[model samples]
Structures are given as C-alpha cells and as structure tokens.
Target: MNVATDFPLREYNTFGMDVTCARFVQIDSADEIPKMADLFDTPHYILGGGSNTLFTDYYNGTILHPAFGGIEMASQSTPTSEGTSSSSVLLRVAAGEPWENLTNYCREHSLYGLENLTGIPGLVGSAPVQNIGAYGVEVKDCIEKVEGYYTDTMQPFCLTSDDCHFGYRDSIFKHELKGRCFITHVWFRLSPQPRFTLTYKALAQALEGREPTLDSVAETVLAIRNSKLPDITQIGCAGSFFKNPVVDQAQHAALLNRFPDLVAYPTGDGMMKLAAGQLIEKAGWKGRREGDAGIYPKQALVIVNYGNAKPEEICNVYRQVIADVKDLFQVTLTPEVNII
Candidate 1:
C-alpha cells in the first residue's frame, strides 16, 4: 500500500479537475486489501481509472485507487500443432489494467467480442461498474465473472455475470455493491474467431467495403469514436456527460409530433430511447461555451473544460443545459458520469 497526503487528482481523472483528497491510498497488491478494513470506517471512495469520474469539489476523505496490473489466460483450448486457435479464450484481467489495453490485446490475439469497445478509456475494473458500452455491444456481454473483496469485512468474493444485474449503463456495482465492494480482477470470455456485432448502423456502414475482422473492427470503432468525441489527452472532459433520455411511448409520440426529425428508438416495455446529442444540438447548446466550460462542438453529449475551468463553472453549464433541455422537451437529462 502506498499512501499520499493531499494528493492532487488533476491527472487521475479524465475531466482533469484540479482537486485534492485528504488521503490517497494505492493498492498495488491483493495482500493490501486485507489491511484496509479499518480505513473504510472513514469517508472514502474506491476509484479506478477515473475516466468516468468527475470530482465536483476537493474531497475531505480518503480515495483508494487500485494499481495492481496483469492479464492471464484463465482458460482456453490449446492452440493446434499448426498454431491455429481452436476455440474461445478466457482472460483474467487485473482491475488496474487500462480498458484500452484489453481491447488491443483482443485485436492482437485475434480474439473477438471487445473490438467495438476499443477506444473507451478507463480501468478494466470500472468496466462492469459502469456497464460501459459502445456500438451496440456492452461489457456485460463479455464479462464472465468479477472478483473482489468487501470493504467492511475485507473478505474475498466473486460474482458471475448474471449476478451483476446489468442494465442500461447500470450494474449491481452502482447500487448493491457501491462503496462496499473493491474489484480486483475481471474474467472475460472471448471468441477466438470473429463474431462481429455490426448491428450499429454507423459501424456497419463504415466497414461495408472492408472485411469485418478483429483488426478492422477495432480500427473502425476507434476512428468513429475519434470523429465524434474529443481526445481526452488534449481536452479535459468525461465522455458522454448525459445518458440518452428514455421516455414512454406517449412521450415519444408527443415529441415526434412537434419535431418530426427527432431520433427515437424503441427500448421495449413501451419506452423509447432518444438520442441525447440530438436533443442538445436541437436546443442550440452544441459548441456553446460559458467561461472555460462548454459542450464539445463535435459531440453535444459531452461537457468539456477548455482550460482552467473551476468545478462550479462546469456544473453550472451542465445544470443550465439540463434545465433548458427540460423546458424545451419536458425530459430530464441525467448525467452518465459519476459526479462526486
């Protein structure tokens, strides 16, 4: 365990918020987990990649960050004498491994299932917690199991994919296990052969002329993502600041009557999911900036920090966006990022 006092978090989070926590504890190994029981009695948060996290203020409590890293083949059919893989592979990825690394690993090893998730930034541990998804494929579909420990008991635990109770951008980690569970490793089952999921229109269209292989799919997904989202390395912003608002059939009908061009898709159960970016753009907020905070011009769903924006400035802009969107569409916009 490594501990730092008043640790700066500007580099830790994607938004690059300049905030500090009273204590920052880095767990480099599983042995340290058993010794962390007492620390949980105080105010604390288990932070992973911090890519999906936005700290609104300087934290007065401890922040535990998992730093251990590794990727091992938990199970897989032996490669044939000719060196051709015969079946799916299982990978046990450490919680701290970059999500991008895992996707790249799949592409390099000719593994399928994670190619579409190529450009998403975050630690592997945060994947299931956020149920991170892109281009019609969700992480939950590949996750075989999650291994972790209870903060209170410091006892080891494991959960199957179904036990995670995954929903649209939601998981048991966000509710039942939030603050209590500390993920150590995630087990994923991926096909050795390509099993493409190009149901997403844009992804399919982009690869129409090209072969739908692991390398091509990975490259295409990253290219499409870069076209819409700003590079976090240059700009400070959490990707997709708001979730697509899901409305009932009646609400969808009402909106469509007024705005015939509205983008809406049935989400079953008589509900429709509207494109949040479209909503924000239609409301004339795209490329709009207040001080250093603004909605990304390329993707209205993202709220950005141009340079040295304070937390309140970012908050104010997003709040205003929510209010304006609500007034215009009567639908409340909910943040997809974790605002702490």
Candidate 2:
C-alpha cells in the first residue's frame, strides 16, 4: 500500500481541478482491504481511473484508490452448432485495469462486444458503476458479473448481471451500493465470432464503405470519439458532462413540432432520449467560455478547462447551461460525470 498526506489531485481527476485530499491511499493487494476499514472512520471516497470524475474543490477526506491490476482468462467454451463452432471466452479483469486496455485486449484476441466502447476512459471497476456506454453498446451488455467487497462491512460479494439492474448509465453501484462497496473485479463474456451492432446512425454511416471487422470497428469508434470529445491527455474535460435527457413521447412530439431537426431515440417505453449535444448547441452555448471554463466547441455536451479553470468557473458554465436549456427546451440536462 502507498500512502500520502495532502496529496495533489490535479492529475488524478480528468477535469484537472487543482485540489487536494486530506489523505490518499492506494492499495496493491486485496489483503490491504481490511486495513482500509479503519479509514472509513474518516470520510473517504473510492477513486478509479478518474476519467468520469470532477473534483469541484479540495476533498477533506481520505481518497482510497485500488491499484491491483490483472486480466485473467477464467473460462472458455466452444459449442458446435450444426458444424459451426460458437466459441466464447470469459475474462476476469481487475478493477484497476484501464478501460482502454480492456478494449485493446479484445481487439488483440479478436474478442467481440467491446468495439463500440473503444475510447471511453476510466477503470474496469468503474465501468459497471456508471454502466458506461457508447455508440450503441453499454457496458452492462458485456458484463457477466461484478466482484467486490462492501466497504462498510468488509464482506466480499459477487452480483450477477441481472442483480446489477443496469439502466442507461446506472447500476447498483451508483445507488444500492453507493459509497459502500469497493469493486475488485469485473467478469466479461466475449466471443470470437464476428458480431457487430451498427445500429447507431453515425457509426453506421462512418463505416459505410468499409467492412466491419473488430479492428475496423474499434478504430472507427475511437476516430468518431476523437472528433468530438477533447483528448483528456491534452484538454481538461470529462467526455460528456450531461446525460442525454429522456422524455415521454408526448413531450417529444411537442419538441419535434417546434424543432423538426431534434434528434432522439426511443427507449421502448414511450420515452424518447434526446441528443443533449444538439440541444446545447441550439442553445447557442457551443464554443462559449466563461473565463477558463467553456463547453467544447466540437461537442456541446462537454465542459472543458482551458489550462487553469477554477472549480467555480466550471460550475458556473454548467449551471448556466442547465438554466438556459431549461428555459428553452423545458428539458432538464443532468450531469453524467460524478461531481465531488
């Protein structure tokens, strides 16, 4: 275990908020989990890859980070179906594994199902927490099970996918087990067979002429992401700050009448998910900046820090966006990124 006091967190969180935690502990082994129980005496937060996190100010508490890393093949099966082999592979990825690394691994192994989620940042453990999704695939679609220990009780537990109750960027981790569990591993079921979900319009159009192979699909997904989201390595920003607002069919019809160009997707329950970026862009906030903080011009869904944005600046921009968007669309834009 590595411990530090008054640790700088600028590099830890993607938003690049200049902040510090009272204590920062990174454990490399599950054996240290028991030791962490005492840390709960003081307020503490579990941190992953810091991709989907925004630190609004100094966190005057312990920040526990699990650094254990490994991706092991736990099982594999090949069933013959009318002379055709339906091969499947199961991988157990440690929480500390970079999400991109997992996607890359899939490509290397010719694994299907993670291609569309290629460029998302964060750790594998964090994947189920937010039910991370992109293109046309959500992390829940590939997750077989999640393994972790409840921080409050220090009892290890594993939950099947059905128990996760995943829904549009949400899972048990964010609610039922919120602030109570430290995820240690995630199990994913992948296949060698070539199966693709190009249902998402943009992704489909982008690959119009090209064949949809694993490499091609992953590369295309990354390319599309690069065109919109700011590279976290350079600009300071969470990919998409707001969750795409979902509305009832009646509301969707009302908005569609006023704005024919409105882009939306049906959620199979008369609920239509509106494109948040389009809404923000139409609100005339794109490329707009408040001092150092601004919505990324390429995609209005992102709030970025131009070198040295203060926490208040970021808050100001997003708040104003919500207020303005609400005034115009009557649709509430909620943040997808966790603000701490």
Candidate 3:
C-alpha cells in the first residue's frame, strides 16, 4: 500500500478541478487488500480513471485507488448443458486497465461485442458501476461477472451478470452495493463470430459505403465521439454531464406536441427517453459560460472548464443548465457524471 497525504486531485479527475484529498492510498494488487482494514473504518472514495467524476469540493477522506492490472483469456469455447458450443471466450481484466485499451485489444484480436464502446474513458472497474454505453451498446450486455472485495468484511465476492441488476447507466455497484465493495476485476464474454451493431444513425452514416467489421465499427464510433466531445487533454471536461431523461408516454406526447423537433427515443416500453442535450440547447444554454466554466458548444451535454475554474463555478453552470431545461420543458434532467 502506497500512501500520500494532501494529495493533489486535479490530475486524478477529468474535470480538472483543483482539489486535494486528506489521504490517498494506492493498492497495487489484490494481495494488498487485506492490509487495508483500517481504511474501511472510515468513509473513502474509490477512484478509477476519473473520467466520469466531478469534484465539486475537496475530498476530506481517504481516496482508494486500485492499480492492479492484467488481462488474459479466462476461458475458451465450452459446451453448455444443451450440448451446444458457447462459441465465446471469457476474458479477465484487471480493474485498473484503461477501458479503451481493452476495446483496442479486442478489436486487434478480431473479438466482437466491445467495438461499439470504444472511445469511452475510464477503467474496467468503473465500467460496471456506470454500465457505460454508446452507439446502441451497453457494457452490461457483455459483462459475465464482476469480482470485488467487500469493504466491511474485507472478503472477496463475485457477482454474475444477472446479479449486477444492470439498468441504464447503473448497476449494483452504483446502488445497493455502492461504497460497500472495491472491484478488483471484471470478466467479459466476447464472441468469435463477427457481430455488428450499427443501429445509431451517426455510426451508420459514417460507415455508409464501407463494410462493417470490428475495426471499422470501432473506428467509426471513436470518430463520432471525437467529433462531438472535447478532447480532455486540451479542454477539461466530463463527457455527458447529464443523462437523457426517460418519461412516461403521456409526458412524451405532450412535450413532442410542444416542441416538434424534440429528439427522443422510444424505450419500447411505456417510457420515452428524451435527449437531454436537445433540451439544454433549446433552453439556450448551449455554448453559454459562467465564470470560467461553460457548456461545450459542439455538445450541449458536456460541461468544460476553460481554465482555472473553481468547482463551484462549474457546479453553478450545471445548476443553471438544469434549471433552464426544467423550466422550459417541464422535464427533470439528472447528471450522468458522478459529482463529488
């Protein structure tokens, strides 16, 4: 266990808010988990790649960062109870592995299922927590199991896909199991057969004439994301600050009548997912800035720090955007990024 005091967190979080943690502990491997009993007694923050986190204030507790890293084929083709070959491979990825790195690896190996999730930032451990999705694909669809250690008992546990209770932008890690465990690794099932999901219009249009393969699909997704989201290296921002709100059919109908161009996607259920960005843009907050914080003009869903913006300034901008959207559309917008 490597420990540091008054650790600078500006570099740890993608938003680039300058903040400090009281204490920061870096666990290099699962073997170090047993020695961290003292940390469990107090409230702590588990940090991954920090891509989806916004630090509204300095954290006063311990920050636990898992640095364990490895990736290997955990299982090969196996027969199921029905005597049919599964035709899938299980991969064990360490919690600290960059999410994009894993996607690139799968593409290079001709693996399917993760191609659409390329360009998403963060670690494998954080993926299940957010149930990260893009281009018509969610990580939950490929997750087989999540391995972690319970903070209270310091005991290791494994939860299968069904056990995760994954929902849109959510999982057990973000709800019932939140803050109770430290995820060490995750298992994903990938297919050998060529499978492509090109339902998203932008992606389909990008690959109009080209044959869709794992590489082509992944590249297109990355390109689409890059065209919209600001590069974190150049501009400090968290991608998609707000989640697309899901409303009942009646509310959807009323809103659609009011705003003819209201962008929405039917949930195939009674609910309709309204585009949060469209609401913000319509509310006239797109490209607007307060202090040093501003919404990315290209994508209204993103909030960026122009320079040395304080956490409160960024948060103020967020609040104003939320208020404007709510007042204009009578719809509530919730943040997808974790605000700390």
What is the per-residue lDDT of model 3 for residues 90-189, given as tens digits with 9 covering 90 to 100? 9999998989889988988878999999998888999999899998999999999999899889998999999999999988888888889989999999
TM-score of each: 0.96, 0.96, 0.97
Rank ordering of all candidates by TM-score, starting from the highest: 3, 2, 1
lDDT of 3: 0.90
Q: Per-residue lDDT for 1-340 in model 2, tens only?
A: 9999999999889988999999999979867886678887678898987888889888999898888888998999888777575678999999899988999899998899999999888888899998999888998998999998888888999999999999998998889899988889999999888999999888999889988999888888889888888988888998899999999999999999999999999899879999999999999999998889999999999999988999999999999999999999999999999899
In candidate 2, which residue pairs get closer than 3 Å at backbone N, Cα or C atoms, i.e. clash? none
Clashing pairs for predicted structure model 3, backbone only: none
True-vs-predicted CA distance for residue 153, candidate 3, Å: 1.6
- Comparing candidate 1 with candidate 2, which one achieves the higher TM-score? 2
Error of 2 at 87 (Å): 2.4
Q: How are the candidates ranked when ordered by lDDT, highest leading?
A: 1, 2, 3
Which candidate comes out best when scored by lDDT?
1
The local lDDT score (0 to 100) that residue 234 gets in candidate 1 is 87
Clashing pairs in 1: none
> All models: lDDT?
0.91, 0.91, 0.90
